[model samples]
Target: MALCTPLTNACKRATASVPSASATSVLKPCSSRWRRGNATVAPPVTQDATSSKGPTAMVFMNMGGPSTTDEVGDFLSRLFADADLIPLGRLQSYVGPLIARRRTPKIQKQYAEIGGGSPIRKWSEYQAAQMCMILDKTSPETAPHKPYVAFRYADPLTEEMYGKLIEDGFGAGKGGRAVAFTQYPQYSCSTTGSSLNELWKWRNRLEGKRATGEVDPEGSIKWSVIDRWPIHSGLVEASAQNIEKTLATYPKGRRDNVVLLFSAHSLPMSVVNRGDPYPAEVAATVYAVMQRLGMKHQYRLVWQSQVGPQPWLGAQTSDTVESLIKKGQTDLILIPIAFTSDHIETLYELDKEIIGEAEQEGVRRVESLNGNPVFIKALADIAKAHLQSGSACSPQMTLRCPGCVSERCLAQKEFFAGQAKHLSAFSQ
Candidate 1:
């Protein structure tokens, strides 16, 4: 992808005004600095000084991990309690805490091994900031793109993010544009869907409540979604480029035959049976990446991180690695196809558990797209296209799964899709 020209005057002014600070200090979320107060008074972001068409919130949504070992319990408790992710039915409230408590010790140890915490929060912040920098240049019509990350099951939770937005004046009886950009390139009810539903829940509670399926009333946040970009060219190019870099590490003679195992977090078979689009979407990403690479090597899409006793999506990533080695194919490259950044899944699960247990020198994993320039540019491209299109959400986003029964899905989809009526007001 060609690079956009230098930052516009508005972007330059925004950048020039920033205080000289350490990179770590600059990348940190501003949530700590600007806390929500009892009074809803805020400097409304009706228009940004940078540009007349400005002050857009580029909120990246993802499933977050605990930042430290001590947070493991709370994290797991929330994760298990989320009915969208783990449906325990009537027993959810009773059984969720029990499962979280029992699993805390083991999960804490996993966090301890991987540098005492998950690096997801750091990478997510960096990715969001970089993408917004690019967006400010490429899409000045939506210039002054402010970055915010709303994570499920962790700090900077959905409510916290919405609060920060209002505190910074995105929405509090004032209209402003915000995009809920899911970091999970592909859409899944268990992942992206869960995040969106939680976002909708908060938007209702913090802002005024509305009919479950009604559009936002006047003077509310004008929202849109970049719901999924499973097969975007930039995504494929980035994945293929990373694979090429990893493949280059092998001996020249062995590189051609090295198996590429594209792995994703496994979904429960029940979710799959419910017609969740995740599996097919993940497969589409892998296929797109392979096609971009001209199908240079043998590859298979495998699943990982199965929890509980229930059958999950497979052939499992670990099993595939062991089987390939048993067949004397020692050289392999595991690619995390489903997620953009590393967390417990990529760091501890794939690295320590899978590769470490395999005891094979030939097996390795590709680096996550953390702070990857190409991937960041791709994010900007996706956001730019969405903002320009003036679509409230993807056409498919309004559709429910064939086997879907959740009223939350029905209402959330309707609420977001309904924003179509208000999008033009912002775009103009």
Candidate 2:
């Protein structure tokens, strides 16, 4: 199948609005610098200066990781504090921190195993830069207004990033500004929703504190949010193609008999039972990729990296592997669909735990399609489409129909509203 292309006409129209001479003018260079233990220091751009138009703003969404062992407590506090993340009411106040503290040793150990810390923030920054490069190549007209920026839920970029962008003169009517959420091929409330809520809160705080002289006038620029891309066919095909490549590396005969295990992060059964479409969405993605591959190989969908005591979606990948081993299955191919890139879940849980189990179970070969180039290109394609079509500002369409309130949505709504009220009191 041919790769999907962005809306060219729309891009042309958007570009034509900017004058040729002005478009060719030298743009203020933006630089990002970081020190090992110090906050990032970016070269300051003159906020008062105006180019032909304003800068393009892009925010990459991420589930921020804990940077220091000491931060584990506060990190869990913020994550659990959000009702959307943990729908358990006031119980979360105590449970959230407790869980983080308990898991700190394990989590810290995992981070230690793969360097000294999680590279999510750094990877996100690199992705933003790569995305900017692609956007520039695809649409040079908007190249000057690089809309590339990274933000995290529990770390440095915080609400402060928004303020910085606004200070550097990015907002509505100033230039072509856009926000892009970074989860490719699949979307989950836990990842995407949490990041977006952070952005919303940051925007609200920055705009709210305007009276306190904390707001940047240039920041008042209009901006649009681009958050979701549901199971695009391009991504599906790319993933399947990547899997085929991985299969090729194995002994020829073993390839055909490989057990194709598609894995995703498991959510609590309460969430799924309540009507969250996460599981269904993940299924759809698996089906799409499987259909594209045209494979008759034995396959199963399994969940990995489950947390909290609440019942999570299953069959757990490790448990499933054990069952398959008993049934005489040997070769295996693990496809991590829940995550776009390798993280703690992928590096430790799936790689260390599951792979170790597979080896112990006598599985001869185990393969993974995590961070394959085709998959990365698929992500770049998704981002390019949004920018080229000027659709980055469009609201994400709901997977569920209106009035369709799955029991999950209803429960989640009630949970969120109550938490919102509670959080609101603290804000006031």
Candidate 3:
């Protein structure tokens, strides 16, 4: 029962502060002395019309995968170069590309099986649109104001999309716009944090070159960002429903015997040591799902898609399956909680390595919950709530929050600055 504040609760507190007073006062005192006096009263702050309209920009943040085998090398190079993603020194320069190239063949095979491309980006787009539709139905006013847009960490929607959005008049200065980060299910430093960092960097770049010809010289856009809604109970319940649907397809009486294996993307130990709550946040999601289902069966949380020699978060999925085999657990159901859609990790790693290992260990049945309808609906619900609330998704606003002090905050600030420098170097 380790306690961690949920994202929704944090947003409520963060946005609940008293509205700032304006210079024009709504009330005029009737006293002659007051009338004669030059004292001025502050006016009430007016809320943005779009704020009532709903979230203006529903930005889907994800670790984009390479579309073609040729792009794999460059993709890995960028991924490895990201200090936030790898945390390894210059070793990533060699190891990153090396591993990516070596795995390219197998990864290519998996993509072929799953229709010659990774579905993550497409599914992300689908999820974003679905969420927009749901929000529109649930909260029509806000829905039209908030349109869905997709951004990727390693692909086309790079920092450039930020400028494009502004140019398209979806930014802050053009009109008081509301934006929400839609990384479904849960958040991780390597994924959500990386995406947000890119957004902030783009914003900084836009602001810095507002007058110069170096970048888009659009009107100054002020952004109110709602980021990182880690785990939503609605989403958890939806995941449970997906699990139930998958389990139902299996033969009866094999249900209770099937071990539920919740999988998330693994990160290096350095990340957790530095105070990233990704692991804990994932575990909480699993707990919520199981609780919603009222299941008494034993479930295990395992890490997947581990790379490099460095220590990654565990128990690794492969090892977990082996241990389960020793305990005579034959049937297993893997729920990829870390990802809301099918991608390289899901199509290649878990479906290949873990499934192969399970077969070798004499496991008979292997069930999986893909990005099904329930899961999509759950995401929609979470996004709708976020739009209505007008709050950032991540718990504690990893960005500078007033009156909060910790070494982690200082480190994040330093990291933010460092990333800016790196991007500047790249641009130059």
Q: Tell me each candidate's RMSD, in Å, in order.
A: 8.0, 11.6, 13.6
lDDT of 1 at 249: 96
* Two-way TM-score contest, 1 vs 3, winner: 1
Expressed as tens digits, the lDDT of each residue in 1-428 for candidate 3 is: 00000000000001112211111111222222211111233221123354344335566666766556556556655665566676666686776566656655655555555455554555555556655666556766553433434454345565655644544444333333435464644555566656666666655555434323333223333344444444576567667877787677667887666788887777777776666767877888888888887876678898776666778788887778878777888777777786665566666566655665566433322222234566657666765565455333343454552332445444444533333222221110
Evaluated with lDDT, which candidate comes out highest?
1
Tens digits of lDDT, candidate 1, 91-202:
9998989988888887788777777777777778888887887887888777778888899988879988898776666666556789999998889898889999999988
From the highest TM-score down, the ranking of the candidates is 1, 2, 3
Local distance difference test values of all predictions, in order: 0.78, 0.52, 0.53
Worst 10 residues of 1 by lDDT: 1-10
TM-score of each: 0.89, 0.73, 0.73
Writing each residue's lDDT as its tens digit, candidate 2 over 107-133 gives 556555655454444455555555555
- Model 2 lowest lDDT segment of ten: 1-10
Off by over 4 Å in 2: 1-54, 67-74, 145-152, 172-176, 208-219, 360-373, 388-428
Candidate 2 has a TM-score of 0.73
Give the Å error, residue 357, model 1: 0.7
